[model samples]
Target: MRETAYWLINIACAIVILVLLGVHMGVMHLDAILARLVGTVPEPLAWENMVNRGKSTTQVVLYIVLLGTALFHGFYGLRTMLLEFFSSDRAARVITAGCVTAGGVLFVTGTAVTVVFALNGAG
Candidate 1:
């Protein structure tokens, strides 16, 4: 059951990413098409309040999941890819560990910063 739950979370994460990818593509294409049609180029949207925006509750949840999953997936991928490509002995393992550790620190620090910003309404 636990394994299934974890698998589901992974699948959900992938699905979330896939959804974001599609949304991104659609927005890019739409922007270009709209620019041509409207004869006015739209400015790129900027995100303020890096922690808590006026976004929906669902968006907040998705943001957290996206942050966590992307960090884990990308970092782990980099580590494994490096381990495969580099045939060095201690140096490679040390580098892999270092990469993972850096990724972990990034995730933790980022999350903490966002959480503080979120709770304090300073975002």
Candidate 2:
């Protein structure tokens, strides 16, 4: 049951990633195109823009969800690949632990950065 749940979760995460990432890419590219049309190109990574985005509750939540799902999806994929390479259950368990640890650290860091941007009003 647990293994099945993991597979199902990964499938759900992948679907979510496809939809969310498409929207993300569209917004980023569209913003650049709109800026160009106005004869002014905005800096993509400007701290002010980032802070502004983070200031919006909806945008901040969306970013947090995207970050979490992407991290889990990518790390779970890595765990699966590592398991494939090692026939030993012990090795696979170790790999899973490592992946989980690394994913947790990265997720926390990403969330913290987002929160910092929101609180500081400047990145």
Task: Report lDDT per candidate.
Answer: 0.63, 0.81
Best by lDDT: 2
Q: lDDT (0-100) at residue 40 of candidate 1?
A: 74
TM-score (all chains, Cα) for each model: 0.53, 0.81
- For this target, which candidate reaches the highest TM-score against the unseen true structure? 2
Candidate 1 structure quality by residue, lDDT tens digits, 1-123: 953664566567677778876655544456677677678754435355323352445544555666787776676566667778786988676966787698789878776765565566553
How good is model 1 by TM-score?
0.53
Q: List the residue pairs that clash in candidate 2.
A: none
Model 2 per-residue lDDT tens digits across residues 1-123: 977888898889899889888867755666777676676755656776656778878877888888888988999898888888885989978998898899899999999988777777762
